[model samples]
Target: MFRWYQRAQVCYVYLSDVSSSVLEGDSPTSLRRKPAIRKSKWFTRGWTLQELIALARVEFFSKEWNSLGDKQSVLLTLHERTGIAVRALEGSPMTIFTIEERMLWAKGRETTREEDAAYSLLDIFDIYMPLIYSKR
Candidate 1:
């Protein structure tokens, strides 16, 4: 998947619930009621980080197959929810952000296996480490 993503000219992202229904008025109370993209299981996955960053051109879609917007239009909202920078989201030529910065994005995210948290980032970081499993 990583290899394919790297070579693909453009990537389309189907954000199943990023529609206007999820976004109400701009009032603080309404904003509080707004659906946060981060809360979605898709955003919480370890592998999704790479998918979000590795692609150069990413198009976002809503649940009803409507186009929410392109990368630029949705970047601020995405960054707010995911804590990833616009630069990284833009897929710069090389990742200028540190590993710690990248890891920060995954802080609240989850994986069924503990090792998957590290394994899913191997390709994104271009590094390898032995995978180990624990009863915890």
Candidate 2:
């Protein structure tokens, strides 16, 4: 999956109320009052980290499919929301960052299966281990 993301030209299209409000006359505060991007299920998923890091390009769209901007325009908000460094969001190689650093970035993100919290990172960390379903 990580390899596919690296090789493929990926664009993330979000049906965002925030992007729509920004397009309209509403202030970011008004958008904030609605559901935040931070609270999004995509951001909280463990597997999403790899996709975010591996993809070189991403696009944001309004509910109506109007282009808001590229991912670069909102790095600060993404950093603030997800605890991910702007450098990471700006296409820095994940290899330059330490495992501990990556783990810290993932602190609050969750997975329905507890093991997936670690397993999702296997490719990001360039490590391989048997997926042991049993905790013991």
Every candidate's lDDT:
0.68, 0.69
Candidate 1 structure quality by residue, lDDT tens digits, 33-85: 22544455567777777777777667766666665565666577668778888
Q: Distance from true position, residue 4, model 1, in Å?
A: 2.4
- Relative to the true structure, candidate 2 has a C-alpha RMSD (angstroms) of 4.3
TM-score of 1: 0.69
- Per-residue error at 128 for model 1, in Å? 4.0
Off by over 4 Å in 2: 15-23, 26-39, 129-136
Q: What is the lDDT of candidate 2?
A: 0.69
Please give, for residues 1-136, the per-residue lDDT of candidate 2 as tens digits.
Answer: 5666789786675744444544455466434423444444567778777767777787666666665555666567667777777788777877888878888887877888989898888877787887788665
